[model samples]
Target: MAVSLDMLSLLPDPLLIIIISLLPFKEAIRTSVFSKSWCNNKLFKLTTNIEFNELFFVKSYQPSIKHLQRKAFLDFITFWIDNNKESIIEKFSLKLSMPNNVSELTEKCIAFATHKGGVKHLELDFSDPKWVEYNNVAPYHKFHEPMFALPKHVYDELKGIQILKLYSCRFVEKDLLNFHALKEVSFGWMEVSIFLINSLISNCKMLESLSLKRCWNFSEFYLRDRNQKLKKLVVDNCSFQYELFRVVAPNLKFFKYSGMMSYFDIKGCPQVEVADLDFSTEFGFGGKGYRLYNFMEDFYSLKVLTVCSYFLQVIPHGSDMLRMERNFNIRHLTIKTQLNKSDYRGIVFMLRSCPMLQCLTIQLGCARIWPNYAQPFASAPKNFWTENVRIYECLKSSLEVLEVKGFQGFDKSEIRMLAYFIQSGKVLKKMTINMEKDIILSCNRNLDLNPRKFAEFLLKVPRASTDLEITIC
Candidate 1:
């Protein structure tokens, strides 16, 4: 009695499918070749991720593949399905980079997905203009919506696809008319209407995670309809007013945004416990107009907060940022510096306010702004980075494990700050720097000291209070 493929697939799941993809095909399908019931039907159960990327290379472009030929790329997908029941396919991704055949390929893909069952996750990306359309500029407004034809019954037909990710693809208002089952959606392009996006989300009963990046066309998009099922959302580099997120996701757990849209009204997301914010504005941050005190009200359950910002140009002085007077209740906080000078004080204030903050990552840098025209320069450059060391020194009280990056060897201000950390960083558990040993000892210099004395000086610190680790990188 020959044990058949059905026996091999008797205990099959996502893990088994992944294991099968890794094995040599001949050996992988040996169970199928053994017997009949173990035959074609059950062999494919241990399978997932059918990628048709092989059908799209530049050197030998398959002309008939896009023409819907009997043996086209989708045909291969159909053959794979016909040979076995692909009930295990969780993610069906297609990234074709051929020239001017995206529409044809797109049509076949949608047809295969609609006709074939079990495709719950789909990532359809035609980011390159050459593959999508033969023009110099892609018709960004039309790709995604057209990928899957406007069906008469989208809710009924697409009841399976849970996660939909489209990059450089178009999403029309009518597309969302049927995407009620969609749980997570991430999309990017030059222009996407917020009104259209809102209409889509309004109808998305099960939609959860929404990430929009670099979409400058329409500025104001609001997720204020607090009754929806959206749990996590991230908006990046879009110029919308701060009033959008005022309602807060009562059930939301993780909320993050990176860009100049600083007017965030957090009163709404009362339930959001974790937030990652990067308000490193290129134009400037702070001014008498900025309402930074709005943050003082309450974030009762906020356990983790990450703040990334650029040089503060308009930070409200004497406010929470510089004064450390505000009250915050987070348990773990990380401040990654995307700012130069102006943004530094605000960050210092944020860390100080978080009396309960346990973990922190203070990085350095600024946000880049893309302008419609060339910028005009008139004023002399201000030295903002000169205060970076001082800011680090300010953080010595709470920071237990300090990791510094982008360090230059032997700068006086930097050394002074390090010296302060060596002595005043009493709470520090470990110090990690990207400089060599010579650089570390430069902090405590003796006029006639050798390397041995320098090493000795470091050995007598407060019971290994300063555990120094140096690396070239």
Candidate 2:
């Protein structure tokens, strides 16, 4: 033990600091008691990255003493900051539930983090886990706890931050400032208005990615910047105040949205290659299928597209507007659905639309059923795939790779769907099927069903491509 301690003390100061930085903040501080050299050397004080998570300090089995815990946490942070005052912090992340009166401490910490223009990545998550659990359905703005309002003066010092993420925090439009060096920004569970969003985009000229999740208080979102450097945009479960959402970022490459259906008039985004749309709708709200069609048609340069079961359920069937001659440039298409009767027409429509599709992935599973959605899991018709099914254009030409996930042998609809693909895919080269054992047992109620036998049965099906290969797992 003496020799080990001597060797540890012999390690270079920079190497010791690097080792200490890998540990949690609390554990790193505890190294002071390991030896006299650790205390005198102050390796923990030299760490460039400081992260404090309340869960690390408060054990799950401990009695809840909110006031005492808060004080201890804050005091520990103050002590660390005092010791590391001269150190250049590259990243500062604090995840804790803040009381309404703790704004001063929060501001102080923010000031220290940006004191010398050193921090490049910063995250401040003040959301209380208990609040999220109790009011899971309500928006963050409706929570009883007051959100931490960002101090206006802090914005002036954030010019050096390249990545910023804030959760359950408040931001005033007037407090917005130019983050010239910022490359990515994420805001969740807050109320962001159109003015605030527009101002952020205009100010952060170097911004490349922006994400907003579970945010409310503004409806009309219009982003129209031609020279923008944005490449990825994600809008998840945000409540829009209007029916129309427009975007015109010419350099965007990836876009993802999950919310209720609306008229998305995305223009000038010729560089978008990947898009994921997860739209939810109730029974009475299923009439806006044309809007989805029109929205999908706008992605002229889309190379990959992903959609949920609800997206298929809402697409209009046999409508003249839906039949308007349009084709997509998508080369890869992924559909997540439960393979129900109502999804048949939509699946066919999507296959027909993607004429250049080279790869198709069908995820056979049930998604989260939103509220007021009636009969979202109804079984497919007995002869749905067999009746009047014609080989689509892509199935005969461009489609070469097919992948099916969550496959169960007993489901007749799933079997027929695979059979249809095997017979129609002229150029198909590789087919992969991932079996779900739990689902198979639950649906069949018999343990004797062998998945290998099912794979063998599929091998007997007629194939249009003589070079096709099949693998099941």
Candidate 3:
């Protein structure tokens, strides 16, 4: 142990600071006892992303314990914030369950991080302690809102602010708010006015990414930028009240939307490389639905695409769509939907369109691995893959990697699809199959599925490519 400590002490100061920064607030502070080398004031300077959470230390909401924990957390935070005085901080995060009246301390902490210290990223989460159990239904959880009053003194300090994330917070739009260096901003479970949202975007000239999740009290969202530098945008579960949803970003490289849009119009985004659309009934495509097809008709620059089951239901199958339009540049594809015999056609239809696809990922129901853009939520098992002979006409020449999750190994449609790919992909290099034993057992309750036996069966299947690598999990 002493030798290990000596080795750690020999690490460069910058590396040591980074190592301490990633640890929890208390754990990071305790490292001072590890060695004299770790006790330098530089450790305090390295404390950039400071985070404090009272609930993490307190087991229950007992008034006495809660009070004590809050006091201790406040003192600890104040000490560090002051210790790092006149220094620049990369991030400062806090999670609290305090009453709205006592929010002065929270504001003070923010002021210290932003006003005194140059904080580039700030995150404040004051939602319900048990917010994980809440639903998207009307009358959502109502946690006390921390009114973030960005007075001139506080707003001016945000010149270096690149990322700002807030949860269950409130803000009143004052004057022209300008975060010149802001690049990414996200607001979740917050009530923000449409005017304020537009104003915020208009000021962030260098903004590259923006996400609004479950933000309420908005009837319409209009996103139009002639000099836009945004590369990624996500608007998920936002309640626009089925009103107008407009976007006209010319430089957007990635776009994702999931919500109800009564009147939707998207134009001028010719640089978009990837797009994910989750459509629902409230999307308002009454009759003149052909316009929807026309909208996507010119996505020749799109290299990757992921569409939900509802999107597949609307678009017709066959090579006609591909034949009529310019050849797509799509080299990677992902589809998320329920798959039985009935939905197999949807997968086949989508595959026929992507002739240059090099990678394919399919996620069904609970088996969803993450959509590559967003952070993954759960550990996804890896199982069945490949396409049928028809896929040979489109993807066999270019498709190199195939990944499938939540494979039950019972559906003949799925097996045929997998067999076709394995036998037809002449250029395929690697294939991954993630199977769930529970799903197989649910299909065949009387018999258990043996992963090893299944692997043996797959190994026996003939492959078109001699160097094909297969992985089953």
Query: Please, what is the whole-model Cα lDDT of each candidate in the order they appear?
Result: 0.52, 0.75, 0.65
Number of the top lDDT candidate: 2
TM-score rank, highest first?
A: 3, 2, 1
Better of 1 and 3 by lDDT: 3
lDDT of 2 at 139: 24
Clashing residue pairs in candidate 2 are 219-241
For model 1, where is the 10-residue window of minimal lDDT? 372-381
lDDT per residue for candidate 1 within 1-473, as digits (tens), equals: 97434554555455555766555443555555654544655544455555555334333346564455423654565565555543445566665533135455555555555555566777665554443321112112233322233233333556667887765555445655576677887775435677666765677767788887655555455555445577888876554533454444567777877655344466666777788865544443324223545553445568777765432223333344353344566766665543333344555566556656555554432233322212121221143232333433334456566555544433333433345556655466766554333533443532243435444554554332544442224
Candidate 2 structure quality by residue, lDDT tens digits, 258-285: 7767678887787899999876433333
Output the TM-score of candidate 3.
Answer: 0.77
Q: What is the C-alpha RMSD of each candidate to the true structure, in Å?
A: 9.4, 6.0, 7.0
Q: lDDT order of candidates, best first?
A: 2, 3, 1
RMSD of 2: 6.0
| Candidate 3: residue pairs that collide | 382-433, 382-434, 383-433, 383-434, 387-420, 387-421
lDDT of 2 at 25: 65
For model 1, the stretches where C-alpha displacement exceeds 4 angstroms are 1-15, 18-46, 51-88, 96-100, 129-156, 171-175, 216-219, 239-246, 285-289, 293-301, 311-321, 338-344, 365-399, 405-419, 434-473
